[model samples]
Target: MEETKIFLITYFAALLGVVPPGLVNMSVAKTCVKRGKKNGIYMAFGASFIVLLQAALAIMLARYIFDNTYINNVLLRAGLVIFLIMMFYFLLMAQRKRKEVEVTPTSGFRSILKGMMIGVLNIFPIPFFVALAAALNVHGDIEYHLLNNTAFVLAASLGTFTTLYLYALFFAKIEAEGTYFARYSNYFMAALMLILVVITFIRIFSQ
Candidate 1:
């Protein structure tokens, strides 16, 4: 029961960790609205592929760090702190630009690559995945361990990408309806991200 509970929590948390907003989702939504659903799905898949790569890398790094408890804990803590700070900054900036921003079209593979780059460059996902791997605690030959990690990462990527796809689709529909909420999603999403960051910090520090 305890083991199952841990896995459930870690899996759900990992899913939440990758959900996009602010710059990433905003760009995708605008692109999808301006271009079409086909382009939007492509952008999502491209971005999600990169996210899977990040999660894979983070899993490898986590395995390496697991041998050293102090180093692992310190790195995890530092990562959490950094992630929170970045999220806060994003929130503030979006709030500041709530009214001045316009949704511009970006519906190409290049735009998809851009979103992936931004998502990967944001290092918060690294430690987030590391923490999940630590929680999962797979033990075996390196290859087996890697497979386990990959499974978790894939699950997370699916959840995150689904969220992105749904959000983009919703925004696209809103745009079609000539609603303004599509343009202002960034502000709301940023605020939600800030809350997530704070909550994550609290959870990490409490541990």
Candidate 2:
């Protein structure tokens, strides 16, 4: 029962986390618009693969991360820098000519690689899962046993994949209905990244 609870909690938390239109899912949606659903799915798989490892690491290091204020502050600072970089990257992409944004065919491997690269670039998940794990531990709702942790990791990965897959699946229809969203997806991403950057900056200084 405890293991089941942990799995459910972690799964829903992860699912909700990715439901927001953010970097990985936005990238997946863009790929679907530019390439195809198959490539988008491949990318989702690649991103989820990284989530598996990240979830595991977070759970394992939960206590240590929670206890170390310096490490936490450093991570926040690093995340701020990363968010700023991503914000600029998306802003630049938004400025490119339509011809430059034309769809290009790519292999599944390449799609997967792109997904993994984006996943790596997104560092927020590590701290998020770490905090979740620490909270669960403090509440006596989680056990660090192998089976429980395995379930937690698997759930996190699956939840992320599910959200990404949905984004890949419906993006085309969304694009057809909302031309603005399609045309300004990069700008939307840049805006979201800027928001993240602001939030991270506040957190760093407030701490």
Candidate 3:
């Protein structure tokens, strides 16, 4: 049951984390529009493959931080500040205009390589997962063991793929309604960050 909970938490985190129109998913959608769903799916697979590595690296970093009591405590306090910053950043993003995604055409296995390249360029996942791991650790929701860590990485990768697949599957609708979706998604992210801020603050004070 605990393992399942860890899996679900990490899965949903990755899923919702990618819901906002971003480089990878937006590229997937654009690929679907310009090339085809097949290519887009291929790209998602490639990106998800990289997510596996990124998640693993993040968990490893989180484990290192967790091993040091002083650092962990400091990070929790720092997390509170970071969460507050993220809240305002997302709120600002919500008010900004979203730009159209431009995709270059690719086909076959090359699409996968293209996706891999794009995934490599996206540097947000590692820190995001690290912070999430820290927060979950504080809540006793995650254990840094082999089984739990594996589940977390696998779930995160699968979650990313699922979101990208959905973007590919619904490219037309997404293209039509993307601005509104992104705006609201940013607002939602801002709200979520605020909640994290509160949680981090309480965790820090309680320690």
Candidate 4:
């Protein structure tokens, strides 16, 4: 019970940590709202599907590295710096790309495939999971470690999707009322994420 709780807390905390990507979530919510709930649900699932894959992969990789001290240290530091930089870049780019863009559906199965690709290509998760593993002091057999990692990520992913879905519903309401959130929202989110990035960098360097 205690171990389970710890894993759950760590996982959810990590998810919260990742949630600074408000633009992405807002984008998803806005698209879903514009397209109607049926389509929005699909987008949510599509976007989140990538998260599932990432969590699984992270679990495996974390387990592998945890058992190897040299690799773990190297990956821990390198992954930390690289992931933080990428997340900072993501925020900066998101801010620059803040103009409302059309969300188009691809033909047939291609749409789903594209969503999966978009989700998978989001590599910001790798270092975050690696950092989580280090923070949690995860180590040992592949199976056991993977299980622990998977559990944490799954919990975190659940929290992330839940937050997005609720945001989608809220955005749908706003769309229904024909009001738009100001562009400043994007800037604000970006600024907040930038602060997080700086803090993460400081932690990485200081460590």
Candidate 5:
């Protein structure tokens, strides 16, 4: 019963962890609207693959950082910096590609690669994953085991994939109605990212 509870909680925990607005989720939505379901799903797969690795690493490494207050503070500061960088990065991309339009993809592989690259750049999730793992450990709510860790990673990936797919479906519906969100998705993404930057800075200052 406890193990099952852990698994389910991990799934939902990851879902809550990821369901917030961010570059990755925005990208997923935009990609689906701009490209197609096939491309969007492929992007989910690539992003989820990275999430799997991230979850595993977080499970292993979160405890060490949690034990050290200095390290935790440093990480929060660094995360704030990373969020600022992402804010500007997306802003520039949005400005440069202001003329982007929806189209059928001539290069399917590139969509997957773009997703992979975005996932790699999205380091903001790392601290959250680490914090969750650390809290679960401190509370003795989860056991650290190879099999269970694998389950957790898979759950995290499923959560991510499902969320992105839902975003894809939602945006695809908009596309179906002739309301193209792609041309301005970059601006939308930048706005959301700017919010994240503010939120992250607040958290760092509070700490």
Candidate 6:
């Protein structure tokens, strides 16, 4: 196969990959709606930075990583717990908002830090590379040379950032609705995450 094709495949694969609705984009949407686009974009960039690294690692270690279902299971379980905690956090945020006290928007290093923290826990991107690998090597194993991996990571990061920013921007449109939306966006996100957690547990138990 030609090098350019491979690069394009990886790029489009990543762009399509992140199009799914998930915790990362949902978090960005929450921030963008409640806080601002600048904050959401910062978080998206930070998360994408970590996703680049995660994609590289998944490509390099696909066999060792994907072959282990236990690891994936554990990750899901941990994610469930994390979402539960976040649910409570947002509940508290809502309570605080009732008193008319302003919650500051996350910005600068803080936004990035929060994004990185969420991104680190977001290991689903590893599965994305596994799918990419399968597509790349229909009949044989993928060859992840540094150049190949670099192209993939760069493309995946851009894709991630693009999709996340789009989601954030969508929610930002909702922010124009008024102050009521701005105040309650966190609870909306929290409820969404809670539903996801319930669904995760259901799938885990079903498996």
The TM-score leader among the candidates is 2
Candidate 5 lDDT tens digits, 95-202: 773453645753667877888887876776567677777766676766778777777777777887788878777777777753346666667877877787787678
Better of 3 and 6 by lDDT: 3
List clashing residue pairs in candidate 6: none
Local lDDT at 200 for model 5: 68
Better candidate number, 2 or 6, judged by lDDT: 2
Clashing pairs in 1: none
Superposed on all Cα atoms, model 6 deviates from the true structure by an RMSD in Å of 2.7
Among all windows of ten consecutive residues in candidate 3, which has the lowest summed lDDT? Answer: 174-183
Candidate numbers sorted by TM-score from highest down: 2, 5, 6, 3, 1, 4
| Weakest 10 consecutive residues of candidate 4 by summed lDDT | 178-187
What's the distance in Å from true for residue 115, model 1?
Answer: 2.1
Best by lDDT: 2
lDDT (CA) for every model shown? 0.62, 0.86, 0.77, 0.56, 0.73, 0.76
What does candidate 3's lDDT look like per residue over 25-73, in tens digits? 8667656665667888999899888998989998888867545668657
Poorest stretch of ten by lDDT in candidate 5 = 97-106
Runs in model 2 deviating more than 4 A are 100-103, 175-179
Models ranked on lDDT: 2, 3, 6, 5, 1, 4
Clashes of 5: 0
lDDT of 4 by residue, 1-207 (tens): 545864677657645854555434655554554455445555556656677667666656775654566664564456445545555665666567445643344443443454465455455565566556655655532233556655766765676566666666766667645224433444444464556556556655664
| Model 6 residue 132 lDDT score | 78
Residue-level lDDT tens digits of model 2 in 74-151? 888888888899899989988887653445658999999999999988888999999888877786755589998988
Cα lDDT of model 6 by residue, 1-207, tens digit = 445656778777777777776778877876776568788888888898998888888777776656677876886788788888888887887777365423357656788878888899776687777667656766675576777777777877887887888877887776666367666767776787788789879967886
Whichever of 1 and 5 has more TM-score, that candidate is 5
Better of 2 and 3 by lDDT: 2
lDDT of 1 at 151: 66
